[model samples]
Target: MKAFDIAIVGAGIFGLSVAKAAHDRGMRVALIEKDTVANGASKGLLGALMPHIPSQWNDKKQFQFDALRTLSEEIAALEEATGVSTGYRRVGRLMPLYTQDKLDHALHRQDESQTRWRTAETGFSFNVVKETPFKDWPAANTAPLGYIWDTLAARANPRLVSAALKAYLEPRITLLEHTKFDRFDEDAGLVHLGDGSTLMAENLVLSAGYEGFDLIKDLTNQSIGSGVKGQSLALKLELPVELPVIYDEGIYVIAHENGTVAVGSTSERDWSHKETEEPTLQAMLDKAIQFCPVLEGAPIIDRWAGIRPKCRKRDPLVGLIPGHKRLWVATGGFKISYGIAHRIAQALMNQIDATSGTQIHLPETFTCAYHFA
Candidate 1:
């Protein structure tokens, strides 16, 4: 039995983020995963790190903005430390402004975004541009209107980020693959594994994506979160300029640094969305073609699908699971998981460190206490 200070189940971005945060703080951690790393929503090809509209300022939006602002530097530092590229960049985003009413609303947000988003460290700006921001950018000839260009928006290679975390913490943490965390004997401070192996840990953290809901249901008999199916596609197309992510309707046209344009994502709440091609996906692709005419003849290299977790409140669910002392959960980021997973991990660790604990100032809406209440 390995004695660890913190034992985290699930190696999604959330779990990996916790492991990195804990390991960096000199805590002995056990990273447990049922499958290989980054197999969940964390590894999705479309890494749209775009910020909120910056209007109607709320704690959750502020938290996400701060995370998005600092993420580039944070990932850069990690890349320098481990020599792994997260493919992160603050390239900004462009959204088609169709009607004048929509343009007026976005312009209003532009002012609001500037007031809050602008700071010393990060100079994120919003503007309504007439001409295309970049050559070969998706002007979407169909909609002969202007675009909203937001400088705060960024993108990251989710797969690379996961790999970087694994590499950075490889030497410091105990990573268990094909290992299942079956049950938690909270009072005994023991974790029962599937292979009949038990681990003694001072505290436990659950950062499992959608599966975390099931784990919590089994342990507490409560359905705290559910999974939302998201489907995306990767296209093999070389672009001349590095364009910002083009978002229109539900389609996201992302031109990655690797010269492959990633387009996609249909949100399906009811039925299962599989990797197999279907009409819904085709409709999205058709809409995408209308949005980005250049991608009309692009090759569809891969289709990726995953279920992002959604808590009751629809924000991130973090903090102690109800009625449990040694157990804690950090999940349900849904679409914004990648944007705020690092901060969620940090906040969870701060919460777990009750005795001589470090101060973690998180939004009230993101805490589990509020969610369960």
Candidate 2:
């Protein structure tokens, strides 16, 4: 039996980030993944780090604002230390305004939450185009409306980011891939594997996404989350468009460094992993081409599907398991996993340290036990 100070299940961005944080603190860490690292939702992510305005987020806005701000610097540091270009670009986001009312509302929100909300003219630049130059563009219907440009929002390569984290933590952490957790012996603090092997750890952290809830339900008797399937595709474009990330007419188009544009996504609640409907793909394609008519001639390169762990509250659940002394969870991030993973991992480490009588403080919302039925 291999013993470790901490055992993390799931090698997605969340799990890898947590492992990296623990390893940085000189804690012996073991990360187990049922599949390859970043093979789950993290791999399928479009890697957009666009933060919602605090005014639009209502109560939970502050946390997101702070997390995004923190991640911007954290990712830069990670990129510097790891020497891996995660394709992080602060190119800003272009959100087109459809109607006068919508523009008024956006301006009002920006004015009301000027301290929290960033808009064009205030560090960011946006313009209202009378006509979109590209053919088959959707901006025709919503033409003459200006766009809200946010300078703080950025984008990154999800696969590169996940790979960089894994590489940086490799020397200090034990990564066990293609292994599934069968169950755990609560009394002994041991996790039994599918191969009839058991590993001991002083603390266990479940960042296993949707598959986590059922695995530990017998011990915790709690349903922490569910999965939301998202389908996205990549297209190879002929012309290189220097557009930042464009969110025109409810569709997202991000230009990648490889001269390929990635467009997504459909948020379907009831969908299976093996399911890939043409309509869904077409819908995304239509929206993408509508947003950028240059994509009309772009060759379709790749398409994929991924499941995002959508919690009951649509927020990440990170804390100690109820009625369990040595178990904790960091799951149900939905789409914010890529952007918020690092900060969430830091917070989880803080919880583990606080449990071990170490003084580390985290926000209450991040470390609270979420109620799931």
What TM-score would each prediction reach against the true structure?
0.95, 0.89
lDDT of candidate 1 over 1-373, digit per residue (tens): 6799989999999999989878877789999999988788887888899788878998888889888877877898999999998878778888888798988898898788767886444677887887676764774464466888888888887898899999988888999988988887888889899999899998899988888898888877878788888888888988753578888897888888777877777666775544645676677888888867788888888888888889867888888888988898888888888888888887887887744435557998888678777
Name the lDDT of candidate 1.
0.83
Best by TM-score: 1
Model 1's number of clashes is 0
Residues 1-373 of candidate 2: C-alpha lDDT, one tens digit per residue = 7899899999988999889888878799999988989898888747777777535454355556656767767788888888987877776676767789977776766565555545433453233344443433334554457666566677888898998897788777889899987766667979888788889998989888787767656666766567888888888764344456777655678887767778887788887564667788888888777656677877778887888887776778888887778888888778778877877888788778855423434445554453543
Stretches of candidate 2 above 4 Å error?
56-59, 117-142, 238-242, 355-368
Scored against the true structure, residue 49 in model 1 reaches a CA lDDT of: 93
